[model samples]
Target: MRGSPAGASFSAAAYLADVFKLKLADLHEGLVEADIKEWLVAEGDEVGEFEDLCFVMTDKASTEISSPVDGKVLKIYHPEGSTAKVGEVLVDIETDGPVAGSEAEAAPAAEPESAPEPAAAAAPAGGAGGEYDEQMITNAAGKSRRVPATPAVRGLARKHKIDLSQVAGNGKDGRVLKGDILKFIESGGAEGGLAPAAPQAPAGGAARAPAAVVPGESRTEKVAPVTKAMIRVMEEANAIPHFGYSDEITLNSLIETRLRLKPVAEAQGIKLTMMPLFIKAASMALTEYPILNSSLSGDKSEITYHGSHNICVAMDTPDGLTVPSIKSVEQLSILDIAAELNRLQELGAAGRLSRGDLEGGTFSLSNVGNIGGTYLSPVIIPGQVAIGAIGALRTLPRFDAEGNVIPAKVINVSWSGDHRIIDGATMARFSNVWKNYLENPDTMILNLK
Candidate 1:
């Protein structure tokens, strides 16, 4: 064999010591793949350990993905708007040596706070919690730093020529929230002769922009990720045979109970709503009829009876509809459930819910009453066997035991169940049990652990 000469073209790649394949790991349960929303870095860019490389949008939530090593990105396997599956390589990087960042970064973002009771354990990922703070990065120059802010906030800052670093952050972990930037600009906080933001017209007198209209004009648009996922889930849900059950229940006792508890909850900085009460009663009812909290496997050969009552509540958010579940509602007190509900609702409104908050739902409840719906045929989520929709409370005259007419507070309830798993009789019985808990708050209180 002849020795290879310098001009013979020995591959330089052979001399490269460490090439790291950054595979997409399991960020949360049931996360098969994530749509890459945007890439923060490009090929040949050097990334610091734990620096975010991209943001991914799953069916229920969006999260940032970080690099696990101090390395230079050799190639990006998935571009923005591409779907990458779990265990698939996301990027290839040339690293210096063994990196310790992978293990810590792969785990799901920890909840900011813990629930008081063990059952109401899942916490919401909201605001500028530690998760967003971790995304703050140092620039390539290693002198300037990137502040943690949403794209909208950054754009607003750019439009005003305001430096985000100079703005004070009041969000969790000192992340620069959009409101903070607005306040900074409004207070004339910009330095170095940057132009102030344009003044707004007086509140009630501001002129509205005229709506533009063009006959026979149309444009095509892609569905948003959240909306697309919801459509896909609904289509899959439509495959299951469904049956509806309806009833009207007196909510007078439940109303009184809430009125009594309102002051207590308010004193403790929690908003007392009927949702926590509904969730509590449903969880209690689930104990007697576990089938309602069960699911059928894909092949329909096996049934899974979940131990905990992970009840999901459908939320109508600014982006779209989201159903984030409250974990183990069975073990939580009404107050505890109220706290968890508050946490989830806030996060859901801001579109900051974690996958953990959205997964492991065994049953669902949708309160259309808040939005003025009288009744709804709520759809069952794919994995869950049943769902309930509640209508607005209305007062109606009913005959008393003495044959005298009396005004009663009532609400319409509609139930949708997987016909394959739940029969009409079982559904009726479950509804009665749940209704009993609400009609008599004392019963629910006595049964509470």
Candidate 2:
């Protein structure tokens, strides 16, 4: 086979092998399929090991796959923009490098490890930690539990109001991925195992025909990818049972403190804003009210109190609205948070935010105050539980110590929490604590980490 010089392994001892089949690597592990955005190397082009040979795009992100061996691109199995399954033979190369053990390039090994029989329980993968552990949350029943699911799965459960714990995981490592919950729903299990929902007819008990568009009345345009992403998430977030609480914090002290520090911060190349203060206040509040800093699991039995205060800052960009996070806010100073917030904004503007930047948030701030929103009820970012919006700062009349009317700076703020774990009273109390840190900057200043 090696002497054939046609589609044979390169390990011909003395003779150079003619070809090597390039199988797709697990670059993005959770992703099942990706569209090849472009192929950087053409047939007959020489390529080196670790050189980016192609680009692939998934819904979450786009990744560049590199060549493993120096080679000449001989045949491209998949074209640009074509979908390819993971581990499939994406391309074939001609190289002097050693080739596979056999001629069947894409076929499995002769003695492939036998797969475990499908169990009632989910399959086990490597322990959920690092990336997988991002979704591994603790249940609220005082039990430390890790649900092996993806972010999309958790988002779906949130949308359908299904309890993941009730739905047995069948994915890798008992991972309760999106398909698991979907399968559970298909199996007549929602809240209770096998308790199905009765089918309901449309209003008026009639099947309606699809509505027709009037001629010359409307024009249709393809949905932009960024907007499409926003649509999916906003629809899911709106579907959740939303309950909100409103509160206000006099911005006088916070404003003064920031104004005083602005010059000092500017000298250090930091354009400090009120956002860092709000983030800092929220982080402090989370320490006192851990529930507000948590995202609820699919099952009502648990609220995963996050160990880190990764607070997301929602920003409006020309592309769309993006909320990237500054991780571990509890450990950051107001200045450090401000720096990270600026860095994240730069990344968002440049369209360089990785999926990691857009996820793993324990809490978030919708700082509409920058754009003149007095108070807007922000929809929770899917997967995470709570979000708060800050209103624009305004001057209001207030009584001074001597009973004289005085102008004071204030901003209205509001909280929208998951009613399951965070109650109205809880929101109120948490808001008060959050406001205390802002109104009394000294409290935050004295306790600054």
Q: What would the per-residue lDDT of candidate 2 be over residues 119-175, giving only the tens digit for each residue?
A: 111111111123322232343445334353433344446545666567676553344
Report clash pairs, candidate 1: none
Clashes per candidate, residues 3 or more apart or on different chains: 0, 8
lDDT of residue 248 for candidate 2: 71
Q: What C-alpha lDDT, on a 0 to 100 scale, does residue 350 get in candidate 2?
A: 36
Off by over 4 Å in 2: 1-57, 62-225, 396-398
* Displacement of the residue 100 alpha carbon in candidate 2, Å: 5.2
TM-score of 1: 0.65
lDDT (C-alpha) at residue 364 in model 2: 84
Residue 212 of model 2, lDDT score = 80
